[model samples]
Target: MSLLSPALRRSPAAASTSVTAAGGADALPLRFAAVGRSFGTGPRARAVLRDIDLALAPGEVVALLGPSGCGKSTLLRGAAGLDTPTTGRVLIDDTPVRAYDERCAVAFQEPRLLPWRTLRANVALGLPAGTERRTGASRVQELLELVGLADQADLRPREVSGGMAQRTSLARALARRPGVLLLDEPFGALDALTRLKMQDLLLAVHRGSPTTVLLVTHDVDEALQLADRIVVLGRSGEDPAASVSQLVPVPGARPRDRGSVELAALRSRLLESLGVDAHRH
Candidate 1:
């Protein structure tokens, strides 16, 4: 559920995600209906995903987890309309997604910033196609402040640390004021301390903005810390394609204790589901 443009916008009254304080413009729901994706044709055909059905409630934060190469990114691409599903469809609220959906914004693992642009200018690139100059500038400034990049707004990509660049990427995505903020391993490259700080910052961002978020992450603890629910994807037995294997709703509340005993138990269970030995790993 990622990437934004000038697409669908919904009323705050319709939003149900309460991970933070609600905002003026709330989130829209996203649904994957019997979706399937395959590559090649005839004898060469290989399915990566089949019958992937998941619904994200308005304003909720859901994290996607799966084994490597289990089509996690592929499914996300389908929702973003960067790639089409071979069957079924992805819908935002009641509308089917079009190419490069404007209702969502994606912050990938890489910052993907243009070296020639200042951080402010990079963020401004996400403004809607028809936005007035003044309004867009204001929005970009607000996002820079939101992501704690206001002081460095004048810097270029080469001038900042990796974490700073990632923050800029987040600010750029939010510049679209997307209904659904899609995060694809956005903190995977950072150091442990930086990653933790970015997680806290994300919560702050959600508290201030109150948009629906669909995050795709490989970290089990990350899923436990931030998500309202964790949806696990995996193949069953010898099945070639992956489908939903578990839908575990996270317990407790936001800003959860990182070392909670309950979370530890859940983490072990999740690791086991992914075929890792809890004690050995």
Candidate 2:
């Protein structure tokens, strides 16, 4: 049986109920309703996801976790409207996400900055066309400073370290002032220290702007630290009808201590769900 039953499928009207059930009326900032995605058709078909029902509330961070090819990123892309779903819908603020808009932005694992452009220009690139040059410039400057890249504004992508480039990508995403930010392992490639720093930065940004965030990652610790709720996608080759296996609530306050017993237990449980024995690592 699917984790989400037919009756439990989310509807626009159910938004209020879901949020209330989740403990507060304004909890969910984003909602997914019977969302499914597939590529091709029939004989040449491949179903990436099926029956996904998720809710991400403002001031809340949710993580998407699963083994590779389990559609973790595919689901994120669908939510971002970077990929269209063959079935169901993705809604932000109860509205469909179809084409790019200022209300939503995404940052991927790689820092996709233009090699030729300086950091400032890269971030400023997302500014709406016909925006006053002065306003655009000010917005870029503000975001650069927010991401701690103000000093590196003149540097090109190649001139900065991987972490710095990723920060630039983050700044660019934030430049849109998106109400929903989708991050697909934005710090996955950084060194350990850099990764932790980036995670902290992400938390700070989310708290400051109070945007709803959906972070896709395989790292259990990452999810535990950043997410208000952790969702585990089924493994590859599993039934397409499967929904998230577990929805683990992350307890504790921001700037959570990773070495704490609570975090360690959550990490171990998540690793186990992913079929990895924590002791073996």
Candidate 3:
């Protein structure tokens, strides 16, 4: 099956190749150099991630897949500076990340919009602290339009459907014009149809802005549908730490054929890699 709908393929934004960062520079590359994370110390210490050396080209989208507690979220969080790695570094544009920077934006599984804030107001919350009032407002308006939420910009979080709320959350994440967009199962909370639409929306958004994306998801099909590369993490040793076990590139262009023989083969491979026996089912 065609991964992208005809309407999505014909979008004007789909023709754009790159998105501008807050400073108008091109999207930045992301790197994880010997990255590892652990909790506690000594015998009680638990390793969550280990020697995660990976790189994402500017405007590339990479999906991470693994079983629970394999540290996919931890790895993504480390890149976002939400959690510091116990070893090595998470770098953007060659500089080591010390804390959350304006260059990175994250969208979580939950919309997490402030209950009291209007969608526009929530989006504006992502603007840098020093943004001029008018500029911030204009940016919020632009992002809302970008995410197809201009009509609902004034609605409160409770007033919108789950899909619309997620769109609002996405608009908020992009309000800062971040070069790196980190997504943690952003569509996992939605129904199947909504999830598919959101996936298409993400592809269109990426085509328009072309920001570097690191998405963590459990769905193999979702990975094939969106990622340029799928990185599977697993624990090779008895240790709990999860490391990159395989890196599989998704062939063809964006909006790939979901039901094509190629995708089917890849899906089977990925499922096997994830410890699933696709043939038995």
Give the Cα error of residue 270 in candidate 3, in Å.
Answer: 0.5
Q: For residues 1-281, write the lDDT of model 2, one tens digit per residue.
A: 11122333322234332222111112236777888877888897887778888876554577988888878888888777788878888887777878654567889999999999999999997676687989889888877877899999999999999999999999888776666788998999999999999998887766556566789997788888887778888834646544677877777767788889978877888898889999875
- Return the top candidate by TM-score: 1
Tell me the tens digit of each residue's lDDT in model 1 across 102-139.
98899999999999999999999988799899988888
The alpha-carbon deviation from the true structure for residue 65 of candidate 2, after best TM-score superposition, in angstroms, is: 0.5
Candidate 1 error regions (>4 Å): 1-23
lDDT of 3 at 37: 92
**Candidate 3 lDDT score at position 61:** 82
How many residue-pair clashes does candidate 1 contain? 5
| TM-score against truth, every candidate | 0.91, 0.87, 0.91
